[model samples]
Target: MRSGSASSEFSRGLIDRSGYASEKFAEGYDRHRLSPPPAVLKILTLVAQAERPRLVVDLGAGTGLSTRVWAGYAEQIVGIEANARMLKWARRVTQEPNIRYVQAFASNTGLCAGSADLVTCAQAFHWMEPAAVLREAGRILRSGGVFAAYDYDVPPAIHPEIDPAFAVHFAARRRARERLGLQAGSATWPKEQHLERIRESGLFCSAREIVCHGFQEVDAVRVTGLAESLGGPRTIFGEAAPEVEETFVHLREAAERVLANRSWPMVVSYRIRLGVK
Candidate 1:
């Protein structure tokens, strides 16, 4: 295992700079975020040719939502996280003995070299320094190990009207963040470039992308909860702009009207960028 300063070029001090280190944000994230689709685990495990992985590492594992899903699939699971508040919640809720949380940056996890059979970044690759994180992933993955970064499309497919309203809220949140000069908790990258980063890292023998969808039954609360989990409206950065709140209200109203008091099924599209070492 690499240790000390040579372990990573990315600065450890910048871990939680993405403005999502607050207690409220972590709570919202854990409560509302959907777990990674089951196909992601099966695909990565298949590509790695491992029926049951010995070790799996989850990067930027906020609140263990992504990490805990691997408990039955791997012999050991390590969730690497940097935010103290998030880690606290993750530890409190997790019950699997095979799963453990480590407070560490994704690019500098102090895990053994070439030790992981699979490494994943769920809904979190964009907040990392891509090149550095990929290098660390390669270093920790044994030959033939798989690296996957996946994120679900937000807002999901609730209702035609409600979905567009959610988009309005999304745009409003981005505009607010820009106006407030607030950035994510780390150096952010575009999620679309995940496959490119993996292939360009020169560590993977093969790389590809897979798209799949999962369905979940949701109510108005979950709809709003999904929006709130993005750390908007009431984030550590303080209250969002009036327009942001207004747009969110519109989304909520739409959700309430469209779904009424009943739960409806929604489709969550997931994109998985995979690499095999």
Candidate 2:
């Protein structure tokens, strides 16, 4: 198959399988999932306090989790998502009158230039092509508007009992990607090389800030569900990796045991970057 056709097929399969995984795991996401990490919540609150933007744009507003955070503060909040299945779930969960969800990609938001006072991408930055997204974000933001990108970094360690399960899960995912001819690189895409690309775009005032924060007392079941729902594992395993299911079960059981003993908080870290348009 041509590269484009192969990519399209891969993406379609990935999205369809992800929708199934999410549906199977939806309750856990809603009930046990941690709210926005502290750094992300702080950034949103800071923007709300600073700009109280009349019109706010949320790119990659997956399942409306971030959209709900800003719905009360912004006069009007527009959530743009590419995945129809996710947008459907967002519509059902997000009922705020000020929030409107659109089916669109981050590269081309279908929004007018200079129309928004703030544009935010929460926990979904790596999924985007930064150079293209930066230009699009710059176009949609009013002069002096803020652009924020916030995401978390998985700690290098896990609790002793939980660590083995995650190791197996990750190993299976790597094998799956290899089978599909995908490359697994560092958590940061385009690495440090892309920082200059963003700065040189001249779309935003040349300044960068990295805000760090930590989270504890996270529910274990929520963590498991979030990892499984993220599409990486299922995309790779494709029903062949028994270890994936076994690891999740082990993790879930361990979490329950830890929760019963009131010793279940997991330490997590995050970073947030903001610039001016």
Candidate 3:
């Protein structure tokens, strides 16, 4: 499975791994991050031809949020995560009898070959070495089994006035991160190329992309919590650089003013790339 040559590239992901290393970050992430949309289960099952998948493996499974979604749909589910902090929370909050967590790299899950009916990476695929991860996913997926990598768009659409401020906050964070040269620790592939990578891997017989949206009711606290849960933005904001702090304050104030202490419907857009082995 090209494990020998691919081993080095896997470690490159560790440099950026620290982005999610903080216990506080994990806690906020678990509390505020939106769980993957229900459509994921239906689509993966339909494509894999497994109404009830025998086994599902979730790679880069942060806090088991994505893994737990499949508990009722799969006979067994395993979450492979490398971060101790995230894994700790994953174990603590997870109560599904059929689900379990394993600390491991996405490129080397250590699962039995051909044992998984479906393999998924949700909101976490961009941080992985695509080719190496695809190789491991291919090795573990049975013929006709599906491998799907999906992510949601950031700054979920809330209110018109608040959305622009949200964009400003994130853009300011990006600028601060670049100005500080904090980008050296990690590497990431462009999300737009996920479908292309899956198709070019040749391990999959076919590949395709899907678009979906999810809606949830959220209050002002949830809005700010979502902002705080972001890795890069959180780090940049923690520095309390005047401009960035001002941007965050602007967002918070906007949310509070616009929502008026009431819950508002929020929409998150998701992109899913699928491959069939």
Q: Over 4 Å off in model 1, which ranges? A: 1-19, 185-188, 236-240
What are the per-residue Cα lDDT tens digits for candidate 1 across 90-182? 998999999999988788888999999999999888767788889989999999999999988866888898999999898777777678766
Candidate 3: list runs displaced more than 4 Å: 1-18, 184-187, 236-241
* Per-model TM-score on C-alpha atoms: 0.91, 0.77, 0.91
Clashing pairs in 1: 17-185, 18-184, 18-185, 18-186, 19-185
Q: Could you tell me the TM-score of candidate 2? A: 0.77
| Lowest lDDT block of 10, candidate 1 | 1-10
Residues 185-262 of candidate 3: C-alpha lDDT, one tens digit per residue = 223477888999899999999999988888889999989988867653365345545677888899999999999879
Question: Could you tell me the lDDT of residue 205 within candidate 3?
Answer: 94
lDDT of 3 at 218: 90
Query: Per-candidate RMSD vs. true structure?
Result: 2.7, 4.8, 2.9
The alpha-carbon deviation from the true structure for residue 110 of candidate 3, after best TM-score superposition, in angstroms, is: 0.8
Looking at model 2, the pairs that clash are none
* Candidate 2 ranges beyond 4 A from true positions: 1-34, 37-41, 44-51, 155-168, 182-197, 214-217, 232-236, 261-265
Clashes of each: 5, 0, 0
